[model samples]
Structure formats: C-alpha cells, structure tokens
Target: MTDSMSDTLNNEIIVPTMAQMAAEGKQPDILFWVGCAGSFDERAQKITRDICKILQHVGISFAVLGTEESCTGDPAKRAGNEFLFQMQAMANIQVLDGYNIKKIVTGCPHCFNTIANEYPGLGGNYEVVHHSQLIQQLINEGNLKAEGGESFKGRRITFHDPCYLGRGNNVYEAPRAALEVLDADLVEMKRCKSNGLCCGAGGAQMFKEPEPGKKDINMERMNDVLEANAQVVASGCPFCMTMLSDGVKHTEKEQEIQVLDIAEITVRANGL
Candidate 1:
C-alpha cells in the first residue's frame, strides 16, 4: 500500500499512547524528534541542539530529524479541529515510519504530551522523553556535569510550569530537577503544578491572537514571578518562554527580570 494510504489506515486503528508503548517494550535507540514549538523558536532550537551535543559527548548515538518534523497538531486538536489534527498526526506518523524512528526526545511540553499521550489513538507510538528527564539521567550517570559559574545565589528565580508539561503530562519534576542541578535558588509560585496559571499561549494560542480576558495569561504568570522577587523565571516549554518573555517586556520589567528555558539555564550552569 502507498505510504499515505497506510497512514490513513493506521489512524483508523486505535493504539496505545507512546508512554504505554514505551512501558510495553525495551527502549529503542536512534531518533530524537523535535516538535514544531522547539523547531520554530530559535532559543528552543538551540536548546535541542545543545542537548544532542551533550548526549553526543556522552557517546549516545542519535540523529535529529528536524526536516522531518511537523506540528504535533496539538493546537488544532486542543482547538477542537480534530480532522486537521488527525491529518497532521497521520503525516507525522508517515515521516516517523519512513525513518523507522524507534525512540524520540522532545523539548516542547505540548509536543511531548501529544506525541507521547495522544498519538496512540492514531496508531503512532514511540518512546518519548522530555529533554530535562534525559539530562537528569545523564547527570546521575556522571555523563553530564555542571561547571559552576558565578552562582545565581542572590538572584531569586521562580518556575512557571507549562500546562502541557506539568498538568497535562504530569512532568513537574524533570524541569525542577534540572534547575536544582544548577544549584539555583528556586522559589515556587503559590500557584504551581496542576494549579499553575496558563501563559495564554497554549492550545495554539501562539498561532492565533489571544481572546480578551481579565488579564493576559502571560501577564498573570509574570506577576506571580515578580511577586516572588525573582530575577529570572524558568520554564520548560518554548511557547511559555516566548509568552512570558513578552509578558516581562510588555510590563516594562525586562530590565528587572528575564525568562529562560530550563535547557538554556542548564547549558549556562555547565559553563557551555
């Protein structure tokens, strides 16, 4: 059967999610999949590249399939455009099948959740992990080390948990773990984890303009960070990074505060 036809057929079959698929078998080795959010943002792309570099230094053999990358259809799916999401999902599955991708690592939380949790329904399944988790593993194995620099000692930082990564996928620890690895003094926001506020950029809000609300989602998150007197705000998802960065800028707090991805901070901690 033609590849497209095969994908269409696969989509019709219900399959276990990627996490379930991972649990069902020995892990596969070879591919690192970057979803649209990571691929589209310069900083996020850098983080993914840096992660691969770190893994390469530790003798992990893998390849990045950026050109083969596509949106996880998360936005469409979350926005209630199931048909478009399915089409996108099928297309991505076709690419993965072509590469025979057995394992995937992603930086974006939304992409991670969608590819790991939702793709099974469309018959695409693979072992997927957030970059933070992988980095933590590397650190534990003595494969990755942080060459401490001027400590962020006095600079208080707060973490804004991305909805998809934290609540949607229950990946609250990895990012926090990564920050802790940096020896960062982290102050938790009153609203964190499942109760964390949205950055207003999820569910494809990044692609479309945000609707009017009592306050901008990003602004709400920024206020929480500012209230903590944090000099830096760290997040796992690129959309969150971008939105929160914009939030700081919009609030005229750019000079007083900064937004960074966990990976970026990790690289810095290691004096990369």
Candidate 2:
C-alpha cells in the first residue's frame, strides 16, 4: 500500500475490479464493516442485522463498527470529488486501525470495492468479503441451513445485479448461491452479471437528481424484470434495491411486482 496507490485508490485511474481485491491474506476475526448505504437505508440496515443474526446463530461473534463507520469515499471518487474521497478513506483507515481490525465483511458492493480494492493505495489493506460470500460459506459449513418448510414458497423471481457487485466486483454467483440454498427459483435477466444495467443510483446518483436520459436506468432494469414476468425482483445492493423499487413505483409496476433484497428474501425463506 503506497501513497501512490492511496492517491490513485479513488483517482479514477485504471485498476483491477473489486473481484480481484483479495488475492491471498490473513484477516481479523471480529469486525464486519457496513458502508454508508447499508447504514443509511433502513432496508439495508435490516439486511445487515439479519446477516449478523444469521452469523451469530452459527456461533460467529462479530462487532459492528457503527459510530466508527464512515463513508468509504466511493461515491465521492466516482463523482470526481477526490479530496473528499481521500479524506474519508483516511478517516476509515484510522478507525479500522484503532480497533486492530484486519478483516471486514460488507453488505454494500461499493463499500466492499473501495475497502478491499482501493484502500491499499492509502496503505489500508484488509481481507474483505461480501456478506453473501460469507453467508454461503456458513451454509457450506453446515452452520446455517435454510428452513425449507414453508418460508421460501413463492412465485418465480429474477435478480438484478448491482454494477459494483456484478460488473465492478464480479460477484455474480455468491448471492445466487444464497438464493439457491433457500430453494429460490432463480431466473436470470437477459442482461446479467458483468453486462447488467445500472440501477440509476450509482456514481453518486443517489445523492443528487438523476440526469436526463431516454429511459431511467432503474426503469430500464425493471422493464427487464417485467419482461421476464417475474413477480419478485431480487437484488443484493441497497442502492440497486432502492432504485429498482423506485422504478417499480415509477412504472406503476408495484401492483404486479415486489422488490426485495437477497438477505430479506433469504430470511423469509429461512422462516426467520
């Protein structure tokens, strides 16, 4: 982690995506980091808590760095606010160091990307895993099992990939794996994975009004779900869930469809 790396962490310089952030490493055992999106959104917060609850049920003891949690500077970096991104990154690094936390799990794809991929430039490096990945591991280890009785019984559904998680981070399968564990009828959108469309809420779009475009990014994605005839649209990222839910509202598709996070869907499946 050099200053140049730190400087370029959010400098919009070409670099590896979030999927390549962890090559091999040792990590701390306690802290699970939740980014601003997870903290700020009630639905995301519920998902985070649900993850923690599931992990705890499996005998994993972890602490949430709530007050110490700050923006990962991802939005700022994406919006060309380099100074703010740098400052926020530094503050996050300092907070992590204060807790001697060397590992983190995040529910937000943007946070996971910044902390895992970009933080090394600022000399802040840690083993970061997305919550879905961790949950998958737990299920594989038999620590957590999906309650297959009546919770997961539902109509057909499709998943919308968040840019940071699906394209930016290359994490297409983990959330799907979690869904599969719950016996979800996973239907793929025509445009999925790295090719998935934006949710109209990334790159700081959540903070400001959306720019004019032929079609709303989120609406375009919702139309894909509608085309699939999916009754439920599932997503992992909060931003994606929010934007897509909005899209459903904007398109007046809520009557015909429902939006849910992977965690929420899983929790329902588990009868929790």
Candidate 3:
C-alpha cells in the first residue's frame, strides 16, 4: 500500500480496465467514474489521482471506463439544455449497460448527482456513490486509516459543501467524517451544510460570464471561508474547488489559504 507518488504516476497504480476485467469474466467491485474535470482539468486530475491512490491503498477492486466515459450532462441540464442533457445521459447509459456496471464512484459531485438521482428515470439505475461517501465507508469499515503526524495534523481546516452534494443530495456527514481522520481542528463556515452558498460555478455559470451583481458568488463564498479563518478549505466537488480557488485568488488570500479536496488530505494522512 505504501507507494511513492512518482511510482504511482508511473506504473504501480492498481487500476484495471473494464474491458480487461470483462474479458477475464471478472467484474470489478466498483467502476471509478472519472468525470470531465477529473479527466481533462489539471487541478481536478490531481484529486482524481489521489482518489485512485486511496482506493488502491484500501484494496478496493475498481476499474475506470477511461475514454469511454463522457459528461454526465449536469452542466448541460443546469444550463437549461434538456435536449443535450438527455442525449449525453443516454449515450453514457449505453456504455454503462454495455459493461453491465453495477456500482460507481466519482470524485465530482455533479457527476455523482446526475448519475445517481437523474439517471434512474432514464433507465440507467445503479449504485452510484460520491468519493467522500465511499471513503467514509472505508474508514468506518476499518479499511482506510489515517496515521498520526501527517500533513494537516492539528491544522485549521474547513469543509465547503458543494451544492450538488450537500443540499442537492443531502450528503453532509461523509466528507466531514473522512476529514475527521486527519485529527485536524475541523472548522465550519458560517454558511455551511444545508445553508451553504453556491461557489458560483453551479448552473453552468462557470462556462459563461456572470450577470450584473455587486460581487461574484465565489467572492462572496470566499468571504465565508476567510471569516472562518481556516488554513485549508476542503472541497468535494471539482467545480467548487475551481470557484473557491479563484475566489481565494480574487481576495488575495492564496498565500494564506489553500483549497484542497477531501481525498488529498486522506492521501497525505496515509503517507501514500
């Protein structure tokens, strides 16, 4: 389970291909759904790697669709393009059905929400789980452990609830439970959980210019993180990470504050 990052980046990653597993007449325990951001976005790709590290360390049998994966249509649907959303959803469903995928785990909440809640109506029902939820289950099941003296130990950390994961899916405890393993001083934003503010990337706003407003929503959300005085802002969604990172930069607090995903902390704590 102990592996250097470079080793992981090279060839030690335990990820298998669904095609390979299928050809061997084997089905993986869960299909790791690397979303658009995790696949293409540079920042999110790190989170994707960390999640894979955690999964490998915990000995979870997993496989990714790789090039076969596509957009979950969360953004398209949020942008009010129902036609495009359905088109994307059905295309993805065909691939999932083709592989007979039963369980799924994603680092992006947008993908988690879309495939979990919205796909049932499109005949793509499956056990879809957010990475945080899976991590929490692993921790609770004594499969994942965070050793002491790791990074973020006794550091001030706060969690930013993503719209799709928190209020949209009511997943409030999983990320926090995952973070608690760090033994850090877990802090909460003034606006958190069900009352959390949007990071301004929701609703396809990230792809377009913002409308007239006194200040950007990410800036406003940054105000809460700053007020919380957290050294690290832990996020579960990639869009939230981008929006909050921009918010921190806009507020000139990047040097003082850091934005990280829950999986990053876990990987660090485990010394992976």
Candidate 4:
C-alpha cells in the first residue's frame, strides 16, 4: 500500500484519513486512532507526528479518522455521563463500520482502554492495540531498528506505566520491550507495572485542578522518577506525558530530567 492520499499538515505530514482512503478505493492496513490529545494537544501532536513517521518508516499503511473522528467518550464515561459516552462511542463506531475498520492502533491508553473494553458493548468490536504494542511488533518483525541510538546509549531511562495501558488493561511488557532495544540503561520507579502509580491525569483530572491532596499525584510520581535517577522518563499516554512534563516543571527538575513519550523515543532511536 505504498500508494496513499495525504492531506498536508503544518509539518507536511502525509496522514491520509480513512475517508480519503475510501474515496481512493484503498483500505489501510490499520486505522491509526489519533485521540484528542494526539490530534490537538501541541505536545501530543509531536508524538502523533513521530507515530506517523514510524508507520511510514516501516511501510505499514495506515490512516486516521481526521475530522470524522470523535472522542471514544472516555472522559464522559469517567465523568459519570453514560448517555454522552454512548452517544460519542456510537458515532465513532458508525464511522469505523462505514470504513470496515478491523484493526486499530492508538497513542492514548484512554482511547485504547475505552474502545477495546467499553465500545464493544456498544457494538464496536475490533482488534485494538496500544501504540507501544504495535511498536514492539514492528521491532520483533525486524522492520524497525534503533540504529541511531547514540543519544540513548548508556543513558538512564525509566518507563512510566499509564493506568489504562497497564493496570487498566494488563499491558506491562510491550513498551518495556520496545525500550530495551534502545541500548539504554533501564531503571524502574518505586511503583511500576501492575502496582503503577497514576500521574493524576486519569479520570478527567487533567482538565481541572486536583481536589486537595497531600501532594499532587504527578509530584509523588515524580518522586519515584527522581528515586530512579533516570535521566529520561518514558511515557506512553499523552495525559501521562502532559502530567509528568508538568511535574518536571513543578519540581524544577526540568534541567535534570526529560519527559518523552515512547513513540518519540522510537523515532529518535530509529533516526527518523
């Protein structure tokens, strides 16, 4: 599927929408579900571009929903509005069904968890995998290589488990496996994997202020990152990326530590 129809973004990104592919009589190998953050959040958009770069680098044909995409209704459901959530989910499922989408890959765990778990009850059933899982697959299939990993070689790095991606969905290895290829010194925080800590961005806390806590959740999570003494903290979720990056600024460790999404790291390591 080297043939693709692309609509230019600010960066000249060649991201074809499923709608465009359908009009061209072409179906992508998978649908890249760029969640709200990946679509609009400035920082998350960079991750979105890197994910696009990876997909292209590996020759995997993919397309996004673009304007036709709606929220997976994760925030609505989390905020206790089942009606709104169902409405949003059904709308998105209709779009997917229209395109006959059978597989999906997304950068946000909230979308992954919601569409993979909750959407099925609303008639949205498809093979959904997190971006990290897809990255691991690419590496295992020998399509992606960290040939330009000089930047990460011998550097201390730690992986933060997004609640929805890890504890919420029991995905504890794919991201770590992807990171292992970087040839970087990998470390673990105090709470990781199944017992991972939330970065406070979950449950729609990202759109509002925290309700009185002893310490901000990201700060506490930052403490674990600090304890790990990792020069770089790798995250999988955009919300986690935002919260942890804010945590870096809050703790004034902006100079000491760097926050990066796993997809961003993969792009760098692959020299894309």
Candidate 5:
C-alpha cells in the first residue's frame, strides 16, 4: 500500500485498467470489478483502494475495468426494471468479454450476486467472488495474515451480513472469515448469518427515501448492534455501510461506535 491509498491513484501503485492491460497484450489473473459505489462513492472508494492494496500485497495479477466499467444492473433489476438491466448487463458483458476476462473479484455483493448468478444466463459466464470471499481465500492460502493488525479487545466487533450477500447468495461465512483473521473480539448480532436483517438498503431501497411515519429499517437494525454491545460493526457491502453509518450517526454513536467495510477493516488490521 502507498500514501495514495486514501487519495487518488499514484505511480507508486500499479492500477492498470483492463483496457490498458489488453492493449499491452496482457491478461491479469482476475478482473477487479469495482461497482458503482466502490467507484464513485467517496467512502466506498477507500474500501476499493484497500481491496486493491490487499490484492497487490498478495502479488495477485489484477486489473480493474476503470473507465470501461458499467453498473452490473443490480439496482435496475432489483427495482423491477428488467429491460434496463438487460441493456446494462449486455454492455458490461461485451466489455468484459472483449478483455477476455475470466475471473472477477468485486467489493460489492450486489455485483458479485448479479455477475455470478445472473450474467451466466446472458452468455456472460465467469467466476466471480466478493472481496470478503477473496479475503478468506488469501488468509487460507497463507498469503495474508494481518501481520500487524489491530485487536478490538476492549470494543468488541460484530459483522453485519449484507442482504444480497447473505440471503440472496447464501454467503454466510466468508465475511466472518475475513474479519476473524484479525486478533479482535468478534461477536454476532442476534439476527445474523442466514437470519440476518437488512440494513434498509436492499432491493434498491437505497435510492429512494423510506416511506414516511414508519420506523426506519436501519434504525431497527441498529438496535441489534446496540444489543450486541459491539463498538465496531463490520460489513461487506457499500450500500449496507451507508445505511449502518447513518444509523450510528442518527443514534449519536459517532465517538463510541463505528461502521466499517470488511476491506477497510482488513487494511487497518494488516497495517496496509
């Protein structure tokens, strides 16, 4: 990792796009699919950089789609706009296949689910894994061990499974697998794993405002975090991070509790 991890890309870190690699007659080991949030959202971009850092740390050959990348059509599909989804999906598939991309790794579970599950049917078959799963694999392979990691012993940590990652795709253990690598006191909210509660951002709920007069779903979910008595809430999705962070802010837990994406935590734990 370089000083540019928190800022814009710099020469110190080699972050070539698929187009650049292809133009150079190169094929990276994996296509890092930085989804909408990871690409544009300021906070999510930090997680994106951390993920890139981790891949670089492990000496994995990877390239991002960069200017060529498009939305995986998750929000459109989740919002019940199939036509728009197909259009977006096809465009992405064309770009991905043009680069001869075979394996993909994403920071967003929505992209992971859409590309891994939906793209195959549209003639875009490829192996896709979320960053959490990749982190688990890297740790398992002895490539990453969080050598100089932070141990949240005093303020226990808990993981909030993204709805798309958990129920939509049944990825229960990977996020925890990534978080557990750190020497931290990890716990679980009452509703976790298969029974995890949504952070009020699933099915494209993130875009529109919640219906008036109803208690916000994220607020209700934050109650679970409070009950767990966790000071740090680890999540794997950027959408969930926004909602959870809003919850912490709404409840005025800024100084006491914090919401972090798995990649961010991994970067910090490993002193990346």
Candidate 6:
C-alpha cells in the first residue's frame, strides 16, 4: 500500500478482554487469537494491532485471550514432537473451553491450521478463521469499505501463500479477496496456489538452521517474487512475513520491495 504499511496506530485502540466480557455476563462475537508470533514477535505484533484496528473500525465485538492464551504448538508439532504438541494443545483447549469461546480469528496461519484442524481431537472445537478470511468476509458484507483509491491503487503486488493456509488447509481465495479491495494489480508467481512455493519458515524450520541446501527456501521463493516484478509482497501469515522480509533483505531489495501482512495492507487502504 503506502511506503510504510506497518505504520503505528495513531488512534486509541479499544480491544476488549474475554475476562471483562465475562464479568459483564456477555461474550464476544469472535476471539482474536494472538498466536505466539502475534503476541511476541515485534513485526507480527503490528499485524495483530492492525487486525484489531480493522475489527474496531468495522465495529465488531472481538476480544483477546490476554493472559489466558498460550502457544498453539504448531512449531512444536511440526518439529516432530507429538507429545509436546498434544500437551500444549490441551492446555490451550482448557483455557478456550473455560472461556466458552465459540469463534476465533488469528493473524498467524500456523495457529489457524493448528486450532482449526489439529485442536479438535484434543477436545477443542471452535470456528477458527485466519485474519485474511475474516477481513474478506467483512468486506463482502459491506462491513469494511476500501473502495476509495487510498494507496496501492495500481501497484504490482504478488501474494506469497503460506503452506499452512494454502496446501495444508486449502484456503486460497480469502486472502486474495482482501487484496482485491486494494485495487492493486495482483500478480501471480509461476508456482502459486496448489503449486505454491513455501517461504521456508513452515514446519518449525524457522526455529532451526537449514539443511545445507544450495539456496535457502526463502531465497528460492523470493526469486519467484522477483520474477513477477512485484513492488510489494503480500503475505497472510506472520511466519511468511518474517521469512519473506528476510528474503527481501537478503536479495538487497529491501528499498525496492516491501513485505506486508494482509491486515496491514487492508488497514492502510481503509485509512485505519
């Protein structure tokens, strides 16, 4: 969108708490699940804030888990530790069940995949959606309007699909719908959709060194972005954001291209 999609929120943000809603004997329309990255990673935190800004702008009743939230164990499970994954999932399930949460939305695809697919068998079952999907729904229902050409009017942007959200879950349209509202020239990589390339950050590879390949997965993936001649790289997952940002830097194209989350782009387009 703009030169700085990660611009700080100048407006006072009002994010409700599940506990506070509970005290009032009420429930939120959706639970904003700030996954581990959204809660702790500096860059990912901005996506979290932007998603909140959009939710607030659209007047949606959403609340965060706050202190009651824990890791979804996506990383742990992907690292091949089923026992640890189960333990972490069970702990989060307990907290979610305690709150009686019904619907969930998160900025991380890792958490989205884990909660929506993996958590069900462990006694955690809730309607979970990625922030991009939620934003698309909002836009479709006329809850979010970004029709005015704010920024990213005709910029060449390419979407980098995360494995968890795409191949793992088969969610390919929601993120694109959110981008369509920006009026940007959405380009496609040679390897996209079902054939999309991984950003090299999935399956907990982000927490460990690579396996001595000729080139890092992210670098290879970045090549596709470069080939598309995109001005901005749109990503829907926080993990993809980190890896793609690194790839842009590694290619020394940080000034020429930008890596932004879908929520960040949506907020910037809507002037949130």
TM-score of each: 0.84, 0.85, 0.94, 0.95, 0.94, 0.94
- Total clashing residue pairs per candidate? 0, 3, 0, 0, 1, 0
Tens digits of per-residue lDDT, candidate 4, 83-169, equal: 999999999999999999999999999999999999898899999999999999999999888985447889999999999999999
Q: What is each predicted model's overall lDDT from 0 to 1? A: 0.74, 0.75, 0.90, 0.90, 0.88, 0.88
Decoy 5 TM-score against native: 0.94
Q: Which stretches of candidate 4 lie over 4 Å from their true place?
A: 1-12
Better model by lDDT: candidate 1 vs candidate 2:
2
Q: Write the per-residue lDDT of candidate 5 for residues 173-212, one digit (tens) a residue.
A: 9888887767678999999998999999988889998888
In model 1, the clashing pairs are none
Q: Between 4 and 6, whose lDDT is larger?
A: 4
Candidates in order: C-alpha RMSD to true structure: 10.1, 10.8, 2.3, 2.6, 2.9, 4.1
* lDDT by residue (tens digit), candidate 3, 1-272: 34434555463666777888888999888999999999999999999988988887776778999888889998999999999999999999999999999999999999999999999999999999999999999999998888742766788999999999999999999999999988799999999999999999999997999999898899889889989999999999999999999988888987999999999888888876
Better of 2 and 5 by TM-score: 5
The candidate that wins on TM-score is 4
User: How many clashing residue pairs, candidate 5?
Assistant: 1
Tell me the lDDT of model 5 at 169. Answer: 90
Clashing residue pairs, backbone N/CA/C < 3 A, model 4: none
Per-residue lDDT of model 2, residues 1-272, tens digit only:
24323433333222221222223332325567767767778867777766655544454545667565788999999999999999999998987876667778888889989999999999898989888788778778876677743455556778888888888888888888877776656788889888888888988999897777787778778778888888888888888878988888988977888888877776666644
Q: Candidate 3 has what TM-score?
A: 0.94
lDDT digits (tens) for residues 57-130 of candidate 1? 45565566545567888899989999999999999988787656767778788888888898887889888888
